[model samples]
Each structure stands twice: as C-alpha cells, then as structure tokens.
Target: MKLYVLSAGAGLLVGIIYSLLNVRSPAPPLVALIGLLGILIGEQVIPVGKQWLSGTAFSTACAKAQAVNHVCGQLPGRQQAGQQAQSAEEKQS
Candidate 1:
C-alpha cells in the first residue's frame, strides 16, 4: 500500500540521515517500539473505561469489545472486514 511505502521511505531517509551524522537513534529500537505500544494502549483506556461505566451487562461487554475493535481498527495495515462477516452471521441466526 501507499501508506506502507511512504512510511518505509521515511524511515529509510531518517536512517540515512542519522548514519551521515554519526548519531544514534534517540532510544534503542525495542524501547522505542514499547513506548509506541504504550501510547496506543493508553489512548484506548479512557474510551473503554467510559463505555464500561455507562452500560449494563451484555451491552457493556459488547460495547467494550467494540471499543477495543475500534482502537485496533486504526492501526496501520490491519483490516476489519471480518467484523462485517461476523455481523452477517449474527443476523442470519
């Protein structure tokens, strides 16, 4: 996809620049990756917490699951087409 290509290009450019400057990345690759993951999880907590506090049983659980799905739906390169398939199956029964 174009988005992936663009991101890869940007990362490659940064690596080249850093190499030319003889400077290390701001953090170790693993540490930086973990920090990014933390940021993503933190973004979903508030919305999911609000859903939990406002709803009753069954709906609350469904809402919480949906909230998580929505959060994950935003991640790059992930597809949510299967969610439609699940909805279709639910409707048939």
Candidate 2:
C-alpha cells in the first residue's frame, strides 16, 4: 500500500513538472500503462521459458521465476504466507 502510494505520488510529481514545462507525455496515458504492463510481463518471459525448456511444469516454472508475484505485485495471500514463514522461523530460533 505504501509502495503504491509512493509510486502514485512520484508519477504525480513528474506530471506536474511536465505540465509546468508545457511538455507532452511521451505516450497517451492508457497506452503508456499498457506498454508498462507489457514490459513487466516480458521481463519474466526468459526466466520462465528457460525453466520450461528444462522440463519443468508451467506452474512450477512460474513459481520458481516468481513471475506471477512480480507481475501482479505481492498479493494478500502471499503476504500472509510470508508472515507465517517468518513466525515459523522465529519459533525455530
């Protein structure tokens, strides 16, 4: 949540600066967003592809590459899982 807020704030700041300079954005907002989405998904392709080529299952390849988490952001269930893991580690300590 904080990261999202910070990202929005940073974008807002840059928009303001561009507005003050009378500069148009490089791309339309919707197009830029879609392009960014593509870039994020594209980044995971190679790692996932390599794992798959090595005979790993699709789901396991994605998990090993953390492609879903990277593209979708850390989900609620993932956060809970991470917290649980931390608790278990602390218990063992």
Candidate 3:
C-alpha cells in the first residue's frame, strides 16, 4: 500500500539522518513494521466482511481481498509467471 511505502521511505530517510548524526534510531524494529502491516490488512478485511455479511455477493468481497493479495505478491498467477520466467531463463542457459 501507499501508506506502507511512505512509512518505509520516511523510516529510511530518518535512518540515514540518524546514521549521519551517530545516534540510534528511535524507530521500531522490522518486526513492528510487519505487525503494523498485519494490522493494516486486518483493517481492510473488515469492510469485505461487512459486504459479505450484507449479502453483497462473495465474488465482490473476494475481488476486494484479491486486490490486497495481488498487491502483496501472493497471487498464484504471479507465482506461476515467475516460475515460467525462471524456466525460460534456464532453457536459454
């Protein structure tokens, strides 16, 4: 998500400044970042859940969830494409 990227960029910028100043970063660790990402995803799930509960159709809710999955690079299609590319590279080699 844009929020995650912006947060990461800000953290990186702050980290560089901290290194230049020879001071420890006050920022949380990578684990905390992962936890924050989980929370962000969990928050998005609520809306899809509400849509499902309101009988808006499973496909619609799934589409919303799939968008998140795709953005996170967890989609099977993406995985297959990577595998195909790797196979092609191996064949050429």
The prediction achieving the highest TM-score against the true structure is 2
Task: Candidate 1: list runs displaced more than 4 Å.
Answer: 1-25, 56-66, 70-93
Off by over 4 Å in 2: 1-24, 75-93
lDDT of 3 by residue, 1-93 (tens): 999999899778767866786766454587457645765566567767887888878768867557466546575488789999999999999
The per-model lDDT (C-alpha) reads 0.66, 0.86, 0.71
Q: Report the Cα lDDT for candidate 2.
A: 0.86
- lDDT winner between 1 and 2, please give it: 2
Error of 3 at 21 (Å): 30
How far is 61's C-alpha from truth in model 3 (Å)? 0.2
TM-scores for all predictions: 0.39, 0.53, 0.33
Q: Native-vs-model 1 lDDT? A: 0.66
| lDDT (Cα, tens digit) per residue for candidate 2, span 1-93 | 999998899779867866887767896788668757976898899999999999999999999988999898984377889999999999999
RMSD list, candidates in order:
8.3, 7.9, 8.3
Residue pairs with backbone atoms closer than 3 Å in model 3 (clashes): none
Q: Write candidate 1's Cα lDDT for 1-93 as tens digits.
A: 999998899778867866786757786888667756765676666766676677646457546556555545554224456677888899999
Cα shift from native, residue 56, model 2 (Å): 0.8
